[model samples]
Target: MIIRRFSGIILLAASLAACNQPQGADDAAGKAAAEQPLTAVTATLPAVYYDSLQVTMSAYYQLSAALVKADTMGADMAAAALKYHLDSLPVARTGLDSSRVAQLAGQASGISAELEGMLIDKNGLDGRRLAFQMVSDQLYDLLRVTPLKNTAIFRQYCPMAFDNRGAHWLSDKTEIVNPYFGDEMLHCGSVTDTLRF
Candidate 1:
């Protein structure tokens, strides 16, 4: 009887230990993750495409920064550089897989067209900002399909831009620097999406 009693006590202690132990570590982890900011996930791209995108995004970032500072000439120059890179993209070059290059090239061509408009737009800074928005949209679409590894691209939106029509732009930073309003309203937007790979 004593042995049986001791066995029962041991079993009860085991049960109580388990009951007192942490029950939902996984649930807690999930909840923590849920509370965290979203990390944009996207399709992986080949090295060539990745390199090209990095270069293009670099120029686009420069253009955006220029606009944020209200530097019209700097923005124009950066746009020209971006155009050159887009134009020089070898969609069917040796070593690069031609299958995906055509599609990428098509998207890039559209971006180049938008940049051209920015280069020639005579409606002053507002016109250029509009053109930049178009370029940003194209880039955003392209990045959705082929995001570069180790890059964080923020998709920002401004409801007051374009006469309240609202607009979106991509930024390399998380801070809201309104390219549309420049110094007039430098921090006039919020990041709506993030693209990372």
Candidate 2:
């Protein structure tokens, strides 16, 4: 681990040093070429859906991090942001059939409702945590029906959560960061399922 860190630092320093060097005309032209945005290729799924869904996913990750820290206020704020994005997600623009689009929209609304519940419950952090389980489940179901392009989603579970009743959460990575237990047992979960399409 230490060696890897040292090697990474060396590589970063090399990159920084390279950046400070004077660039020739050829180098400038090459840089400009590299900076050009690649045109979106035609795919079965629409690119607009991917971009909009990415924003919602980013907000979901922020909520997950807040929960991992046991910060109720932060979690509430993040969840509010997530709910806002979820409510605004463009299911109609996803290029799915009418029935599929309706299903996806319903699932998104379900997750948004859970977030609202988490935000309003008098039970505070526990309520938020409780609602998160359903939110995760709804997300998993949504993904199973409506696949996202070039994305891998992990369904992680903590068996020790809620007195061994077990609960599942979706993560973009396989690493186990238990949101249910927070710092108490951060690594008490495992990746039980992976979805990529």
Candidate 3:
């Protein structure tokens, strides 16, 4: 991801991806989150705004889990929820400088458009994956500015995605759940970066 200076340092969010479960994978995932519920953003924003962003992140995690399972219906549902959160983000109310606020707003807009593209009636599975790739990219940019409050977030990547064009996604865990290929290559990615907040 492109590194940008916010104040005097570069900004970032986390690393991740998740899809098809192996037996009790759901149990494991849930347990991990229960152990460390990263339910807020570090940005100085109103509580309601923070809750909105938290739900957005939750939806994104759901989308990733569905992708790992190659579950189209699930992905559709999660994408819709994500779109709502992205659209309603209250960036202006956040206690940040003009540049950072504008950056988050622009990225949120990009994320909304990408999620919409993913939900188009004719886009199908491949289209959804492609759109998710963009969403992941834009999310990465957005997270750079609006850091999530968590112990650690991993940035996962797969050079084989999109016919080797490559793709990246954020994860709360260190495991690799390749959303692009889902079950076919669920573990195809690797951790590229880790952010702790």
Candidate 4:
């Protein structure tokens, strides 16, 4: 009877040890996983492409605002802005066929020409506004697709460029935070927010 009791106690202890061993191993694994750095996933867009897209979008908004206000000074500023943006477009051959690059550049050129006309003509407000809206719509549509393709590229290549710099687009007379590390919050509009005529 005593031998039976001793054997039972030894079996129970062994069972408990076996159970505890797995728990310890699991705990260690959990800790290791927690400590591991988040593996940076690739973005869909390259930094150059992403940045160019962002700049063009920003210029579109600015030009649209100028058109609505009939602010000649604003329009002039936007012309320079648009020119600068167009100049900054990524020209590097990123495996894209020449035909595709030419097509994109042609679209950009058309937008630039519209902006130049708006700036040059004193009475081109109505025509300018229409052109601005058309260009803005086209760019936004392109962006919807561009955002997905370049997501991994932008995240991996340009972390700062992916941040929200146009948060003020929804607010009425709100200050917009600069995306590229600036102290000033640019004063933007809620006009685009409503999408109303």
Candidate 5:
């Protein structure tokens, strides 16, 4: 009778141990799953958007330089260049769905119409200057509010070129120090500082 009781106690202990083992294993698996990082959404932006952005940025830089030079001719030329690029941007041929691509194309077309009116009116230097500034400001606001604001990929690609610093905008400054193009000096030394010629 003593042997039988001891055997019964051993069997109960083994059953308890078996139950506890699975709980411990489940806890470990749960921890590992919780610790794993989430996958990023794959980027699928259309190429036309990139082309438009590049053209717009180049036009902005050129217009800024022209403003500094006080060259109405140069400013007009750059504005015309901007208009041409904006007009010629092809509808997205790949990536995005048809409806989305159509919407983007329509927006581009509207922008092109506004630019065409500005160019055809021969609105003079001041008018062109104001329009250029407006475009630049709009692009800045768009970048702040859209993909640039939310995506790590955009942050990695489109580094900040300038930031307002007290009395001037400083450019080419960032935390991750680049060995080649270290902090670029601000070009606000004088009215002629940014003029190419």
Candidate 6:
């Protein structure tokens, strides 16, 4: 009777141990799946969306690089270039429904206006950084729905950029060279998300 009781106890312990092992493996698997690249989120978009987006992103990179180098004039020129591309975005090029395209255009128009005003503002580098922040927020929304193909756009953040409220920008590269702080804290941000095309 004593041996039977001991055997029963051993069986119960083995079952409990087996149950715990699978749960741990499952948790690890879940994390691995969640960490995968965001490439699968993109859908087929119109050619104009891709072309204009690429041009606009290139202009943004120029502005970011200029800020990193602390060149206000360069930033101005880059912002102007970005504005030009933003204005040229074709509204009819979206494969999405008309309502969705209109929504996208509305957002794009907001970004353009901010960029144009920033170009005229004399508030200097601080003002420009703030303008860039607005542009980034709007552009991020637009890109979320119309992602580029075969490319990875990184959304980066700098917690120290604007009065400690934080700021975000998109980059084709993963390296962080903060535009808000310029050379004061050039590498002050990190890649928050990698949106792959």
Per-model TM against the reference: 0.72, 0.75, 0.73, 0.46, 0.45, 0.76
Model 3 spans with C-alpha error above 4 angstroms: 1-43, 97-100
Candidate 2 error regions (>4 Å) = 1-43
Candidate lDDT scores, in order, read: 0.76, 0.77, 0.73, 0.45, 0.44, 0.76
Best by TM-score: 6
The RMSD of every model to the true structure, in order and in angstroms, is 18.6, 15.6, 15.0, 22.8, 24.5, 15.3
User: By the TM-score metric, which is better: model 1 or model 2?
Assistant: 2
Say which prediction, candidate 2 or candidate 3, comes out ahead on TM-score.
2
If the candidates were sorted by their TM-score against the true structure, best first, what order would they fall in? 6, 2, 3, 1, 4, 5
In Å, residue 160's CA in model 1 sits off its true spot by: 0.4
lDDT of 3 by residue, 15-37 (tens): 12222212144644664566432
Error of 3 at 109 (Å): 1.1
lDDT tens string, model 6, 38-154? 222245777767888898989988988887787889989999999999888886676666876677778778889999998888578888889989888778777776777779999
RMSD of 1: 18.6
Q: Taking the tens digit of each residue's C-alpha lDDT, what string does model 1 give over 27-47?
A: 447645764322333434456
TM-score of candidate 5 relative to the true fold: 0.45
Candidate 2 residue-wise lDDT, 1-197, digit = tens: 99999999997676445323333457447645764322322347677777777788888888888889988988999899999988988888877668767767877998999998888884777788888888887777666665667889888877656765667788998887889888777776777678887
lDDT of model 4 at position 96: 56
Identify the superior model by TM-score, candidate 1 or candidate 6.
Answer: 6
